[model samples]
Target: MKIALCVKQVPDTSDIKWTENNTMQREGVESIINPYDIYAIEAALKFKKNYNAEVTVFTMGPLQAVDMLKNIIALGIDRGVVISDRKFAGADTYATGITLSAAIKKELPDFDIILCGQFAIDGDTGQTGPCIANLLNIPQLTFIKDISEYNENSITASRFLDDGIELVKVKCPALLCMLKSDFEPSRALINGIIKAQNSDIKILTFEDLGLNPEDVGLKGSPTYVSKAFRPDIKHSGEKHYCLENNSGAQIIYDKMKEIGVFNG
Candidate 1:
């Protein structure tokens, strides 16, 4: 089976920084694989283990993102592809999806399944996977908590919903937006690390993908941020004590009245 996992390199949430334009400041921050994408990786690895599948991981980022790709390869992915180009910078979810779809078609046209995280922590939009599916005109199963069965032709998985879980069976060549599962990503081994270090990461550019510059990056993004700022939150410590008696009830009533909790 040929499986493609769409991954992302994101800033560590604990040390997030924003640019003057309200975008993420990624230059000096420590970048790691998107935490949720780890689950997608784990799912792909599970397939490789159980079914002898070949997994290729893809990410769209700058040249610096190669390090993250190497780390993913060290996690036992068969290959890694980084779609890096200056035109891909500042791409919104729409442009990102378009670019990724084009890359996937150009590079791995025969892939059986595509997996991605439910959302990236930085944007928290959860739109890329579905958007890619739309662009590719393929079936999309989202909020997937578990993939129960798979084969060369179809996949059966349990999807998460607000109320309950639903069992879904979809044909092959589908995209899945995965949620974190009970299975954690394994640590890279020494041999795997060495292999990754020696592996040649395929770098794809805009020209290679045949994407027009006007249709990518900030230029293609329809949404714009007007302003970004951290809201000021303040806490006040005020306590009230009530005795266990009628007077206590009266005290509570009075406090409620004082705070306008009671109109009368």
Candidate 2:
């Protein structure tokens, strides 16, 4: 099976930088792989181990992202493809998805499955994966907690929903957006690290992918951030301290209920 993994190099959330226009400043900021992509990597490695599947990772960023690709490549993936170009800068989720879809069409046309994180930390819109599926015209299952099995004709997965878990069997050539779950990420193997050093990272430019500047980056983006600011830290007006097994807690709850707090 051919598994295509879409990953991203995001600025370390703790030390993020923003531009005057509200877009993230990724050029010089210290960056790391999106934390949620760890789940996607873990899932891809599982497929690789169980089914002997060939795994390839795809990402879009500046030219420096080559280093990020190599870093993940050391995690036992086969190869990496980076979509890098100045024209791709400031791309919103929609344009980003378009670019990635085009890259996948040109690079991994025969891929049987595509895996992505539920959302990227930087964007947090959770729109790119579904957008890619829409553009590619493939079935997509989001909020996926686990992938039990992948057979020739279909793949079994469980979606993590708020109310309950939903299990479904999907046909091949589909996309799965992985949700955060309790699992350790796979470590870098020695042989994998060696392979990464020797592997040649493939680069696809906007023109190389036959994408127009007007259709990508800030230009192609249909939406823009009008304003950006941190919300004020507002705390609740009342504070009550209750000792263990104290009736005061119940009294406070009942009084709040009397006041129709949350209609409880």
Candidate 3:
């Protein structure tokens, strides 16, 4: 079985700085692999160990994102691919999915599964994984909590749902978005770290992915952020105290009354 793990580089939550354009300042901002992606990688690593399959970590971002790939390689993945170029900047979920789909189609064949984190920390949109699956026209399951029961031709797992949980089954060559905390990520072995430091990853440019200028980046994005601002913090609210033996409901009612909820 062959597995592909899609990971992303995000600004370290601890140290965040903004650019003049209000976008995250990547230059010098400490970065780490997306936490959710770690879970996906760990899942892939488990499969690789049990089945002796090839594990490839794939990422797309600025040149600095190569660091993230190095971090993954240290975990003993077979190889890594860095899809980086200036033209890929400002790509929204739609364009990102399109580009990744194209890359997967062009670079890989005979892969049995694709895995990704639930969402990128920086974006928090939780859209890219499903978007990639949609672009590939493959079956997908998100928020997967387990995969040990998975098989070569199909998989059975539980997904997160608003009401509670949902059990899902999907055929192979499918995509999954996993919650990072679902499994504990492994640390890099000493030997693996040394190998990773010297591993040669295939660095792909925009052209390598067969993407045109019009098909990626901000121009390719359908949505745009018109404005962004930090909302003023407001911390004033009405508090009610119990009168005599009044119940909690009565206190809430009195507070609402004071706020004129009873008034027409």
Quote each prediction's TM-score: 0.87, 0.86, 0.85
Q: What's model 1's lDDT at 37?
A: 96
- What RMSD, rounded to one decimal, does every model reach? 3.8, 3.9, 4.3
Better candidate by TM-score, 2 or 3: 2
lDDT for each residue of candidate 2 in 1-264, tens digit (9 for 90 to 100): 898999998878888777776677767778888988889998998998899989889999988889888888899888999999989999999999999999999999998899999988878999999999999999999999899987775889999899999999999899999988887777889988898999999999988899888999999899898888765689866666667667787887899899889684
- Candidate 1 residues 1-264, lDDT tens each? 888899998888989777765677767888888988999998898889988989989999989878898998898998989999988889999999989999999889999899999999989999999999999999999999899998658899999999999999999899999998776569998998999999999999988988888888889887777777766586795555645444667777888999999698
Q: Write the per-residue lDDT of candidate 3 for residues 25-81, one digit (tens) a residue.
A: 667887789988988888888888877879888888887777778878899788888
How much lDDT does candidate 2 score? Answer: 0.89
Q: Which scores better on lDDT, 2 or 3? A: 2
TM-score of 3: 0.85
Among all windows of 10 consecutive residues in model 1, the one with the lowest summed lDDT is 237-246
Each prediction's Cα lDDT score? 0.89, 0.89, 0.83
